[model samples]
Target: MSELNHVPRRPLIAAFLSLCCGPLGQLYAGRGKRSVTLAVVTLVLMIVAAPIALWIPGGHVSFKLLMFAFACWPVFLIVDAFQCARKARQQRLHWYQRWWLYPLVFLAYLGPVSLISELRTVFIAEAFLIPTGSMHPTITPGDRILVNKLGSRDDVIDYGNVVVYYSKGPGSPLYVTRVVALEGDTIEIRDESVFVNGKQISEPYAAFDGELPTYPNMVSMQPVVVPPRHFFALSDSRRRSMDSRMLGPVPIDYFQGVASRIFWSRPRQIDFSVSPENSQIGAIAWERIGMPIR
Candidate 1:
């Protein structure tokens, strides 16, 4: 007599496990060798994708294609696991194939994966959703941005660099604006014209939003020297940007990172009519997706 018990694998169980993590479904279906191979492949793909998604400067369309490929891969794995389970004959269960081992294995894998992801978010890059149009034409409301936390080095920051930083203090919320003045530079605003070190700097991205004459009081400021280890930032939407003008010069340590690109964006309502089926609702701003932030 055989020493082990033979039992049929459930297709639904296999599919669900695959959905959780690529190789898991195959493991449940008693394909130990295939599951190990799939696990290695999936791990390699994730390691490759992370750096490309964060640092590579590809075309907006190409970035979307990468995202689409990643989304489709899991679906392929799930389907494969389901079909394999359906065709698999009853087989002797090994020690690793115990019913209790499934969830235990999942938890063991999930713990380390979650930890690495959280570490990356804290020290490398993080995604943010724009809730206001303070940056306006440069960064509109509903735009989802990727911020490079590793690129916030004070030495690399320069005039016109868009940065994300703390609003007031270490524990405060983050704000995004363009750097206009560096440490030890004299910065002034006269009639909405910016001057760094007494020379008026070009501001092609600046916008008045048709309210130029209305905020005359807020548009001009006397010359102010940026202190050591500090920088001045302002919004492109001069008429209504709550930037360094309101918050004052920001300390270098307060900076979180540089705004990298628009990973995703929600479409404006005026661009398309609403559909009864809600198809148009929550539509994406396709043109802005993957656009780099200068």
Candidate 2:
């Protein structure tokens, strides 16, 4: 009877570790080889899938698939940990022996995984919230946008491309604006209308809050040639935006990424200038959610 009966195992503890840092519970349950295998597989999948999903055409579909895979990964680890704990109990393995291993296992398993995830966010892509109406009509003050850090890699930054760049000014460190002129292009503003290479460009995305032919006292400047490796950018709201006209052309190195799409948006009280105040209580703009930014 003693040989036939299985010792009891704590399923809750196993599940907690697996969910917190995948496969860690398996090691705790004395399934060392299996835990190592699961960790390697998860890391390999992320390494292979992330770049493909971000860089290739029709990659959004692959990205969705990868996201689904990630969602399932933790669940699989939890189930495996529970099952392994049961097996270890059945095999009459001591549950609490070698207690010193827990600390080492945690540092080895969780530390590297956390570092890799952070590095991915820093280099691959990330999201940001729009706090101003500068890009209004296209992107509003309460919209959350995804920025693809790899968007400009191996590609040319063309006119009309919306980008996010690090600003060295007093406001936010990052600013979102549209590229009006690329390297070697001539840009001039006449009465708020943008002229590139001596030709007036059509700007359907541009918006003005009030009935005004042009922004009053808007600085008018002569044609200026964009220096190499730099870009001239402006906001859609010509009247309210502080852009290249005030800061000069942005350097290529200052660029952080390109705006991919609007993930979320909300309409805030018109009077509130602070972002947190606007988000406190507001109706969701369902129509604007998931809207793609051009």
Which numbered prediction scores highest in TM-score against the true structure?
Answer: 1
After the best TM-score superposition of candidate 1, give how far the Cα of residue 196 lies from its true spot, in angstroms. Answer: 0.8
Model 1 stretches with alpha carbons more than 4 Å out: 1-3, 210-217, 268-282
Q: Each candidate: what lDDT?
A: 0.80, 0.73
Evaluate model 2: give its lDDT.
0.73
Predicted candidate 1 versus true structure: per-residue lDDT over 151-226, tens digit per residue: 5476657789899889997999889999999999998888888889999998888888744545433688888899
The CA lDDT at 219 in model 1 is 82
Per-residue lDDT tens digits for candidate 2, residues 214-286, read 4333446678899988899989977777788878788887887788766567754444344424444377786
- Candidate closest to the true structure, highest lDDT: 1
